[model samples]
Target: MNLRDIDLNLLLVFDRMLAERRVSAVAQSLGLSQPAVSNALARLRRALGDELFLRTAQGMVPTPLAMQLAEPVAAAMSALHGALNQSTAFDPATSTRSFTLAMTDIGEVYFTPRLMERLNQVAPGIRISTVRNTAVNLRDEMEAGQVDIAIGLLPQLKAGFYQRRLFMQRYVCLFGKQHPLAAKSRLTLKDFASADHVLIQAAGTGHGQVDEQMAAQGIARKVRLVVPHFVAVGHILQSQPMIATVPEKLARALAEPFGLAVRAHPADLPQVAINAFWHARFHREPGNRWLRELLTETFAEG
Candidate 1:
């Protein structure tokens, strides 16, 4: 426990190991060989007097002590990184950093085009990659610096994460312009319950907010189609007379392209709070902050 005896570099390795539990991956990230990483871990174990990580079939699992040390160590590393890069100018036009984003199908449909357009004009050298946001393992990935930011409804993001609200979305019914219900100004509960519906099944087995709200009132929708993603909703509605309840932004985006119509859902469903989520460790990162600022300005519908 002597501060003078500890090598600060060892703490850096410890922090990386806490984020990326695998030794080989940590070595690759840190530009060290496999033996070097193992040697560092051995030193950390002796210095801390605890076997911080345990190797299992699933990879390295952090012990309770390691979990307890994760936040403070990560925060320290982040602070040091920011301090070291404080004077470094972040010129978007000259930077060639790649950022990975996590979002749902609806989110990708709504945000990617706008974000890409802005980046293309201003930050030509920057690159972007996307992954679906399941709100699962998101925290670990963000902490590990794998996902730069996630754009969607992340009500489950924990305390150490940072989030900024971009806009508020509401459920709207989508159907082909020629469908029978398209002429209705606003749908009624009876009309909604009786219509053939196309439900977007993003998760394996779950219902949308509209369906849950309807069920609360003892109404059951006759869902005739269940698709795995929101992209299919537009195509299905274009060819069939099925109604789909989707986010307002998504409905509007596809309305003209697919020749579809949008209407307010009959039941009063809760408005979706769309936000950008990232770990606090990346909050002050130069490139990450730039992307966040750009997204906040681009989707500033609140």
Candidate 2:
């Protein structure tokens, strides 16, 4: 079938339908009515001479032809989107676009306040919203233009995207000011192993690298608590005689506020590089470029 013969707009519907297998979801994401999405699917089916997707109880299951066409169609759509947005001018002060960013808990703590401050002063109308990186598939969401950019140690956003390193941070042990280890400027391996630990399994991020690095050296800490986020670690350490391993910069931020003391990690952990990732489709998008440049300028460590 010749591409020119079919309505190119139908391809947009087809692509979204593939990403979100349900008609209702496609409709919601595309800002169209459920019937409208179904109608477009019907027209595409007639034009293509194939039942591209089979309606099933679970979701709209793609047929063999749909599966075959998915990649090329997605690529073409992305390229076309890039081309359309390439020349558009983005005036931050005047634009009222709301951009959704994917971030981990630590990322929100480190990035949000600063970003908001700068944005409020410069781009007062533009809005910023955030979603947990673990909550959505970063690659898929970014490719679909649902997520503007992701920040943190997202190792999954590798292929088909661009990444810029904001900074490298080593792990530090945060201890209560009154804790026995806090007396020492730096912690020793013996102090680390003897103390009960609050392990922040910052899932969906590269925080696990800390654990792996520790294990490689045969250093084992007594895991007293395992939390999923970094928010409460400072509070936990403040009240308990526990050492929490965390990013050095974050540790310093929490030290005085939480009555916690930051010390060099007893174990030599690999430095984790925090990065910003955006899909190639939106690499040249004027607004996207502005946001990423804002992130770099505000946070990049020399």
Candidate 3:
């Protein structure tokens, strides 16, 4: 029979009857009348094309099909009931659960410290595990429940996922105090293009939007080194003449202790907006809601 022809509630009655055996006992357990329980069983039998319950000396014997469906039906009912009973009031103080997040190194460096501090204040026992964002089956990993939240500059996300923009970042040029260009408050496009640059290619591509911007202006940078992380770029620029183009916030943080200088890009560089994403299945989940709220708040503070 087609699903439209059957009432899923009949499965719940059938599961309860199969557990309690007698129709009267099932009725009492579900707080329904005996006649209602009998009617439900009749409907279930007709739908399954089998007499799911055979009355015997032992009260009721379940058929093979009914027995096979018992565990799955019970599990589905339990999950449904739990979801319906979810609480909107999240208590982080007593929760000892761990959250798994997928993010790039740049996100980790900028956001994690504030998040951990908040977590310690509200949920001391809670832990966070971070997974590196790679260019592989991201949708499959999220759907499989391998990661709870994915945060990055996801330009092309597939359907069936929920996304929200956290914050936008602008590109800036960073140089050491000893560099020749450090004296200039504002860098010109010619100075940027002529300078030796350290490119932070997180996705293994030496070329990115900045490269495209330079190409549009009929200028190209002298790429002296290519690295994977902004942190690495920060460290490398400390003792070298290589100037790196990075997110403005990262450049500011690195410039503080590394004795580096930050300058705005002369060309109109495209802004990178970081987004927080999760599977649609978790759009209504309580724990997921708590985590996403905290993330938004933390990022806003930064």
Candidate 4:
């Protein structure tokens, strides 16, 4: 008989009736009516093309075919019971799950080291894989469970995604510590406008707004170099006298390591809010919830 033609629930009745030997006991044990139990047994007999059980003064007697299926069917039900009772909670320390995060270069620079340190302490078995949001479709990746979380200033993650603000970061000017303008207590508007700039056109990450806002304030800089990401900006600024206007977090991290100095932007520029974003599909997932909480506890500003 085709497997599709049989209802697996019918197997439950067969196993119960075999041990109880009476339709009344099988119906009470299964919380099914006697008529339902009898009907299920009839369906099972017809599908197997045998009289699985025969009625007798002793309540019911199993046929040879029923005796043959008794062990396997009972074993299958026991396994299903165990599976249905298994715990569904996610234990970070025990889980070897690898999560994919979507981030910008700046996010990688600011968030990864500390995150790894925290994970190593509490969730050493868990691993992280990062993908550039620019290289992949952020929405599609999160939807498909390919990317677990995205952390940065991603305007594209809006419309259908959920987000939580981690902190606010201000824009500042970064330059070599030994640059001529470094000795000044505060950079003047002229110093900002006339200085040669390293324009970081971080197109996909939405950091291009820094330049747009600068232009809107009529504070235009003389850009001597153009680059795509903040990852290499520190190294370039260490050797070059040109300025890179970047977020305060990146500036703070790169300043001491790269022999760079940070100065507040002379013109008014709005601060950007860094946020953690995920698709609604994974909002209640245990792993996703754990990661989201870890980020908030580790980095979120009060």
Candidate 5:
């Protein structure tokens, strides 16, 4: 395997393939076609004299050879990127750099519009992309720089990471203003448990904070509908007597527009912290620092 026979671009493709494990996803990230990514992988396989990856039901599975190469290659690329950014200044007004944020659907609904509007006003040329923030993949994505910043409820940061608290999200009960529950000035735990509920099972975890708090008191509410996000809660509330427990930020944002009413949650569930996370490697990168600061300022306004 002669170094002269290898293309540096192929290594980049390989690196992204290791992160994404799918040709199409890697192509989208690199702005290349699926065929082009496939062709690059073929070249990489031939040059390296091994099947770097294998297609599997999960997507592309890295071979032992690829797994062996992943860490050093990622380190080299990260260091090169850091060094290049250090050598130059990032002028948000002029930089055409793209930022990828890892977040959940709720985060997208609550944060994207404001963030994009702010960026358009100050950094018009900058582009933003979002990836689903699954608990399983966030750390690896951040480490590889596939995701620039992650927002929402993040895992506890180990060393070599930076995180800032954006806000603490408290849950509130939401119902249509015309619903029977809306007549009550104060809602009790029994009142909450008696109502048919619309559960926003965003994580597919079968249960949520509401359930945990209710179980502690040995109470259970019947879930009449289960949906993945707060967006669906509005529509369900409009047509049914069902109640939903959602983040205060979401309830406040939608209550007026959706003609819904918010009530304090009767259950004493703890508020969760919404946070922003970035790698220590990107902590000093001017563009990342700018973005982190922008996110901090933008969400703090909410």
Candidate 6:
């Protein structure tokens, strides 16, 4: 098919259909009649050489090709919207916009309160959505405009995305106040290895790395549980005999209130650096620049 012959507006309807998964909902979102949306979908299906969507009892389910095109199409629309909405003067006081952020549990716990406080002070009507940080393809998310910002220790990031170091944090061992380890001022590698542990593997880098680190020192910790987030680890340690190693900043935040004791890691473990990530496309955008500045300021204070 000739690119010049295709109408770009059909992509907008396709994106809405993907998001709402119902013709009526897509029509409502686009402020069009149901028949108008259906007509647009018909044009899109011919342009894309596929049915695009199948009517199921649940909703309008996307074909495999439609599913594959969803992210890029949505991202393009978002970028277009942002470009059209750009202004020389950004008055946060009157602007009502929602921003989506991808961050780890620790980041959400530490940075969100400060961010929300600042937003409320300046933009009372603004909204925010936070997505879980997973070991997924983030470069595509940023490039497509699905995620405005990503905050975490994304060591294996792809090229083209801009990164700024936000803060440096080390890991510390945490246990319940009433646990036996809490009685000790410090813990040795042997103490850490012998205890039942709760492992927080956010990046899906299984316990192999931790085990390898311990094995280098001829130590082995019995990993009784493997959780996806540090918050869950804290919950497990609250009443259990499980000891967990978590980022020092997060541990410090939860230590007192959770009645947990923190101790230094016996072995020389790697210190994690948290960073803010964004697409180069927004490197000069005024609103994006302002948001990045706010993020840096908030994290720097901690």
Give me the candidate number with maximum TM-score: 1
**135-170: candidate 1 lDDT, tens digit per residue:** 567778999889999888776776668889999878
Every candidate's CA RMSD: 2.3, 3.1, 12.0, 17.0, 5.7, 5.4
**Per-residue lDDT value at 128 in model 2:** 90
Each model's backbone clash number: 0, 0, 0, 0, 0, 0
Error of 3 at 27 (Å): 33
1-302, model 4: which lDDT tens digit per residue? Answer: 67688899999888777667789988998899999998998888888899988989977898999878865775576557546644568899899999998888888999999999999999999999998977645665675468999999887776446899999999998999988999987999998888899999987887888888878878878989999888999999999899989999999999999999999889888889889998665666678879999999999996
> Against the unseen true structure, what C-alpha lDDT does each candidate score?
0.85, 0.86, 0.78, 0.85, 0.82, 0.78
Cα lDDT for residue 204, model 1? 28
TM-score of 1: 0.91
Per-residue CA lDDT of candidate 2, range 91-126, in tens?
Answer: 999989999999877877778888999999999999
Q: Give the winner by TM-score: 2 or 5.
A: 2
Residue-wise lDDT of candidate 5 within 133-187, one digit each (tens)?
Answer: 7657677678767789988775545545678889887888999999888999889
Model 2 regions more than 4 Å off: 1-7, 27-58, 61-72
* Candidate scoring better on lDDT of 5 and 6: 5
**Model 1, runs deviating above 4 Å:** 1-5, 204-210
lDDT (tens digit, per residue) of candidate 3 on 132-182: 756465654664456889888775554557887888888889989888999
Ranking by lDDT: 2, 1, 4, 5, 3, 6
lDDT of 1: 0.85
Model 6: per-residue Cα lDDT over 1-302, one tens digit each: 67688788888888777657789987887899999999999988877789989999988888999878866675577678668767667667887877778887887888788899998897787788898657364555665457888888776553446788888777789999989988999998778878998877766422235546667877677989987667676677899998887778888888887889999988887766778888765666666777888788778535
Q: Which of 2 and 4 is the better model by TM-score?
A: 2
Candidate 3 versus truth, CA RMSD in Å, comes to 12.0
- How far out, in Å, is residue 45 in model 5? 20
Candidate 4: which stretches are off by over 4 Å?
A: 1-87
